[model samples]
Target: MAKDFHPPYPWQTGLWQQLRHDRQQLGHALLLYGRAGIGKYAFARYLSQALLCKQPHSGHPCGECASCHWFNEESHPDFRLLSPEQAAESDDESAPSKKTKKKTQISVSQIRDLNEFLSLSSHRNDGARIVLIQPAEALNAASANALLKMLEEPAPDVIFILVANQLQRLLPTIISRCQKVSMPAPSESQALAWLSEQGVQNAQQQLAYASGSPIQVVNEQAQLTTLADIWQQLALGSKLQPHLAASMLIAHSAETGIIALQKWLCDLLTMRLTKQVHYHIGQSGALQGLSDKVNLSQLMQLQKKVDELRKLALHPLNHELQLEALLVEYTRVFVNK
Candidate 1:
């Protein structure tokens, strides 16, 4: 319905094209699984538009049509979307806080709200009623079970598109009810080329740091500009300096920030393995020194450690304690260096 519907990325176009065709014949429900920020949300939206479009071109929706305009304005009564609340109100905003509030998970209430919204007949009376639920795993057991019931007996001409970052977290019954579509990460070279084309001066460096995610690299470049100083200390294996740096980094950005730092470590290790001297996104003189200090085995171990920590981040853990433990463990791994 939106006139400004951005097309899927070049890599994602084929998948969307396929989904468009499926919608033409009227698919009931779909589960779209992909890593975050890979345009899963956008793709779901594109599909929703195609289904509701009164004047579609082949399988694609005509953006210029009236239905498309309503969709774009987010006024289409048939269209619904649900996502986790971004930030909760802090108790003490006036005082300096050490930690921010976590993004709350989607609960049974949201799903219940959706059930009520969809139970009624379509507002438009004829087009498909579309619902897009992102990071659907944020649902608690009660919420998930509620969704399961709806999927089992979906209304006629209704579509449910569930997007998830971690498919494994979903119940098997939930996954089995809908068609599964995998959104693979782009190839390393393809991601790097996209970054470079976007005028990233150090495309090689950034791509290596990002680990095949252009958005992650670009986002880190903008958000973690201070990481350079912290990384420099870590590269030199300055024990005291790294602890301080880690503290500062953790203090500034929580789980997501640490995830980016883990990406940096992975990139350095990747370069170490391949003996590639350049970074795709940005310059980092410390990479070479760090590579020399840590062997391939050590780097691989650290990479695994990072992954373990990232998985824990998805849960309702104590952020402060988790970060402190993570930093301490990170230091202990390369203490010999």
Candidate 2:
């Protein structure tokens, strides 16, 4: 569903221009892929809305038109958004289930349901129909196969925009049917300038912490206090209590807490070997302290384990216990010399 349709970030200007330049020869499906948190989804939404708008200006939507109003209100007949959560919500709304478990994939049924929409003509004369599937890697095997059929015989007047952060996860057949657009990530200076414009303090720290993603910096700012507390507990190293630290860490989410530890461990591993600190330059002293005391072999193993856990973070597992076990292992990696 469409949220507040803020224009794409400033760094996306070049890519935006490129998309507009090729508007006439656009394919039935466009695959927009790039780094996470770099505003790929937002760009796709903007482009889709622009294409559906009755009065598009220079490849962007004319914000005042009735079509644009319908788009902003998430009621545009010609536009459909297919994401895991959105698909589940629609099912729940119609089926009236008792708080069904959240879905994680673009299900086969969701893709099959598109047939009904594809059979209908556009609501307006000469208006282009659009379907935007965000994080396209969320398509499971069956769903991907169903979608592959659509791509093979694309319905007229419909444009499918598949946005993905992890392109490697997509099927080769699926990727081949679409026109691929490689989204750009802003440089450090560009990202910092944008963060400055947003009046975000400590932009440099947030930028590095977010791996140069400005959107990530903005999102993480909301949880800075929690992150700082987690970092402090991590800085305790061998002294950190696994149960206590896990309690604080799980206050956010298992994924958040694991990512924090993974970052810290990454820096610890790197600093131990390369004398380089990446994500937590602000906590270089803490990282360096842990790096000196941590067992190199054990640290490497734990890093791998933590990385693996991140992939399974969305599973309905006991996250607090998992985190506690990880933290206990984290403490073991450090020992009194």
Which candidate's TM-score is highest? 2
lDDT of 2 at 173: 98
C-alpha RMSD for every candidate: 5.8, 3.0
Cα error of candidate 2 at position 233, Å = 1.6
Per-residue CA lDDT of model 2 for 245-335, tens digit only, reads 9988778777788888888899998899998888887888888888899998999999898898888887767878888888899999987
lDDT of candidate 1?
A: 0.69
lDDT of 2 at 310: 85
TM-score of model 1 (CA atoms): 0.72
User: Which TM-score value belongs to model 2?
Assistant: 0.90
Q: Cα deviation in Å at residue 103, candidate 2?
A: 3.0
Q: After superposition, how far is residue 183 of candidate 2 from its true place, in Å?
A: 1.1
lDDT of 1 by residue, 1-337 (tens): 1222254666787777776666555457788898875667777788889888889888788988888999999888898877665212232244336234354566676778877777888877787788888778887798889989999899887888889888999989999998889975667776666666666666565565555566666656655456666566555542534446556666555676567557667657766677554332343455655666665665677678668777667455565555555555555545354
Each prediction's TM-score versus the true structure:
0.72, 0.90
